[model samples]
Target: MKKVVLITGASSGLGKSIGEFLHEKGYTVYGTSRNPDKITDSVFRLLQLEVRDVESINNAVAKLLAAEGRIDVLVNNAGVGILGPLEEIPTDEIRNNFETNLFGPIEVMKAVLPQMRIQKSGLIINITSIAGYMGLPYRSVYSASKGALEYVTEALRMEVKPFGIEVTNVAPGEFATNIAAHRYHVRVSQASPYGAYAKTIEVINSQVGGGDDPALMGGAIYKIINTPKPNIHYKVGPFLSRFSIVLKRILPDKMYEKMLMNHYKL
Candidate 1:
């Protein structure tokens, strides 16, 4: 039987790329979007999924199982970006960010685990970011959300290992995607000292637009799922960006902060 795969936020970008690549390899791919009608991919079945909604998440999984009989792999790629100084970002906006980036995937994993446990085999991939490893200047909350998700992935691996379910966090540095368009850009007050760093926003956006191809991440995910045993964390992106992960691990906190601020020219 073809391995069944489910990917969230598959309307475009990395999620769509992953779904398309896996479908080409004969996996029965089911993808989710907030608006299924907007998913133009004919190669995979698309389902309407509002990740923040419990009913929507549970129903999507149920619908997929009804059609495919099993869900062999899940890529939790659904997430939103909130850009601004943490103090200036609205409370609701921060909550919504976590709701989508952190809680959403956890709930989805909860919904899928029973079947995965029953089968004694399954793979769960959580899409995080290099920013998660080190907090970015204006995108503090976005970093926090992804960082929290990484911790969740770490704890979850131990909990689910005995059941034969595997979990890994995929941290991508910069990728060309529509995510930049949807980012919640905060208007910094001129009087606030952080206002000077506002220009960094435009710089960040430019980097994202010129970043690595989404197909690279798709290819990485494909290899990850097929590996007999995968590492707990996989970082993908341009060489310098992926190398930052190692730098963050070895450098002192102050030195790392200096390097990060210098990179953004803050």
Candidate 2:
């Protein structure tokens, strides 16, 4: 029997790449996006879904279940990134980020667990970020969201292991994607005094211009899906990402802060 894989946030970026790769590998792939009308992929079936909405999730799951009868893999790739100083970023924007990045995946997991439990076999892959393991200057809220997701992935892995269900978290560092292009709802105020960091912020945003390719992340996802026993967390990207994770673990807090300040020339 062919396995069925459902991927959210499949309109573009790593999610779209994973959908295409898995579909070619013989899995029945269902790619989801908020603007379903925009998704006209002949490679995989596209379903309309917004991970932040419960009703949207339920409807998408019903449509897939009715057609496929079972879901073997659930890829929760829907997320948003909001970058700015913590004090400057609006509280509502932070809440919205959590809704889409952390709670959204938890909602999808809830909607799919019943079916996976009944089947006694399944895999859940959550697309987190290397930011989940370490913090950065202007991405406080985004980092917190991914950190919460990492915790959820760890808890779910142990909770569902007895049922023969596998949970994997994919943490990719600075991938080339339109996430920075379509950065939703970033409000900057000239009234604020922290304007000195404006140029630094611009430089950081510009660096996102030539990050790692999204295809590499897609290939990493493919490998994790096919591995006999995948690790709880898989980090993808350049060597610097690995080094950053290690530095976070070993470096003193003040020294780490100084290092980041110097690296960004802040």
Candidate 3:
């Protein structure tokens, strides 16, 4: 049977790419957006879903189950990026990032798990970030939010294993997505103490503009879905980004920090 897949935040960017790719590969793909009526060119079905709202999450899940009767895969790809100095970022904004990047995905997973468990098979893939593996300048909140979801996947995967559910995190490095345009930025004044912080945004944007293809993430997700035993985490990006995680594993604490500082020109 063709697997049924539900992908959130699929209005555009990586989520849209993944959804389109899977649709071509013959999976039944349902992509979600706050306003599905506006996406006129989607190759697959689009559902109206707002991850921040629990009712929206449940309704979308319930609707999909009603149509398909079983959901085989879920891509928790709905997330927003936050930028600027940590100290300058407001507490409420930080919480909001956690809400969308962390809590929202959790709620979507919760809504799908019962039906998945009943079927005795399902896969949950959380779209995380390479930045989640490290603390980068001006992206402290984004990193922390994605990083928390990574940890949640670690524990949740083990807990759900007995019922045949597989949970994993897919961390993508900078991709040429409009994530930059949509990010929640903490505007710093010209005389802010964190002078280097403002300048780093340029470098970050340049990298993302020149980043790897977003379809690569789709390919990565497709492969993981086919694998008999998908690992806890799958990273898709430029070699340096993926290797940075390795460097973090072996390099001394301060040395790794220094490398990042130098990379960001901080």
Candidate 4:
């Protein structure tokens, strides 16, 4: 039987790329967006789902199972990006980022585990970030949120091993997407303490626009889905982006910190 795959936040960006790629490979693909009514051009079915809301998550899963009977793969790609100095970012924004980036994926996993356990096989790919591997200067919360999910993937994968469910994280460094436009950016002020943060934001947006194509992530996801035993962590992006993670492991803490500071020109 063709596998049934569900991807959250698939209205656009990397999520849409994955859905389209998997659909072409003959899988039954269902993607979710907060407002499905507005998304009409996707190759796969689009359902209404809000990661921040448990009711919306449960409802979307129920509708999928009722229609497809089994959900073999899930891509928890629903997340938000937050950019600003830690001290300047509002507490509520931090909480909201966790709600979408960390808690959201966990709840989706909870909703799917029962069915996956019954089927005796399933795969979950949580879209994290390379920044999660190391704390970025101004994007501390974004790093923390993605970093927390990485650990969640580590813990949940082991816990669900006996039930035949596989959970893993795929951290994408940067991709050519409209993510720059959607990020929760705290408006910079001329007199703010972290005035340099405005420059950091500009650098970030420039990199995002120049990042690897989303199709590359789609290709990477396809390979992971077909693997009999997927690793706990995978990353997709340009060479420098992926290499940065390796450097962090081998470089001294202060040296790595200096490199980051110099790169962001902080």
lDDT of each: 0.91, 0.86, 0.94, 0.94
How many clashing residue pairs, candidate 4?
0
- For this target, which candidate reaches the highest TM-score against the unseen true structure? 4
lDDT of 4 by residue, 186-228 (tens): 9978888888987898899989989998988888999999999
Q: Write the residue-wise lDDT of candidate 2 on 1-266 in tens digits.
A: 88899999988988988888887788899999898887565478889999889999999999999999999999999998888878878899899999999999999999999999999989999999898887777788888999999999999999999998999998888777888776653456788766646765676676667678887876887788788788998888877876788898899999999988887767
Ranking of candidates on TM-score, top first: 4, 3, 1, 2
lDDT of 1 by residue, 84-131 (tens): 877788899989999999999999999999999999999999999998
Model 4 segments more than 4 A misplaced:
none
Instruction: Determine which window of 10 residues in candidate 3 has minimal summed lDDT.
Output: 194-203
Using all chains and alpha carbons, the TM-scores for the candidates as numbered come to: 0.97, 0.95, 0.98, 0.99
Candidate 1 stretches with Cα past 4 Å from truth are none
User: So what's the TM-score on candidate 3?
Assistant: 0.98
Better of 2 and 4 by lDDT: 4
Tell me the tens digit of each residue's lDDT in model 3 across 1-266: 99999999999999999998999999999999999999899998999999889999999998999999999999999999999888889999999999999999999999999999999999999999999998888899999999999999999999999999999999999899999999999788988998887678888989999999999888999999999899998889999889999999999999999998998889
